[model samples]
Target: MKAQVLIRPKAGILDPQGIAVEQALPALGFGGVSNVRVGRLVELDVEDPEQLDAMCQKLLANPLIEDYEVLTSS
Candidate 1:
């Protein structure tokens, strides 16, 4: 099975990368883009789909300031 993990900072958490991008967008000719948040995508092949969540919680995400979602594909 193929698994994808999407990891992102939790809401209300200060995101410096997101802030920097949001501030730079207007100067780069991109407008009206707000609430910009940066995240990570991890794609891998897993023998057990059931272990995906555990992977996210244990290592893939902080679980304190970050949240993760798992998607499995056949």
Candidate 2:
């Protein structure tokens, strides 16, 4: 099994990285790209995305402001 973890800044928080990426998207040949939010993609060799989500809320991410989703594939 594998897990993909997306660690991003919480809403209403300052994300300079995301902002920079959003501004550079058009210059990088990406058309109509707006509101780009940069995040981290962590692919883990594991069992469940749900379990990972729980782990994220518990340890990986801050549930107070951050939003996250889980998807599992076999």
Candidate 3:
């Protein structure tokens, strides 16, 4: 099975990269953009999908400052 992990900073956390992108959008002709949050995606091939959450909690995402979601590709 193919697994996908989406990791992102938790709410109320400061995101400098997101802020930079948001600030540059208007100059690039894109407007009305707000609350931009940056995140990362990880793809893996695994035999068991159930273990993905543990992987996220242990290695993929920082439990104190980030959140993650695991998805399986059918």
Best by lDDT: 1
Error of 2 at 34 (Å): 1.5
On the 0 to 100 scale, the lDDT of residue 32 in model 3 is 100
How does candidate 3 score on lDDT?
0.93
Better by lDDT, candidate 3 or 2:
3
Per-residue lDDT tens digits for candidate 1, residues 1-74, read 99899999999998999999999999999999999999999999999898888889889999999989998899
Tens digit of per-residue lDDT, candidate 2, span 1-74: 76666777788887788889888888889888767787766667775445786688797677776666655556
Task: Estimate the TM-score of every prediction.
Answer: 0.96, 0.66, 0.95
- Each candidate's clash count: 0, 0, 0
Instruction: Give the distance in Å from residue 63's predicted Cα in candidate 3 to where it truly belongs.
Output: 0.9
Clashes of 3: 0
lDDT of model 1 at position 20: 99
Decreasing TM-score order of the candidates: 1, 3, 2
Cα displacement (angstroms), candidate 2, residue 41, comes to: 1.3
Worst 10 residues of 3 by lDDT: 48-57
Q: After superposition, how far is residue 11 of candidate 3 from its true place, in Å?
A: 0.5
User: After TM-score superposition, what is the CA distance of residue 71 in candidate 2 from its true location, in Å?
Assistant: 1.6
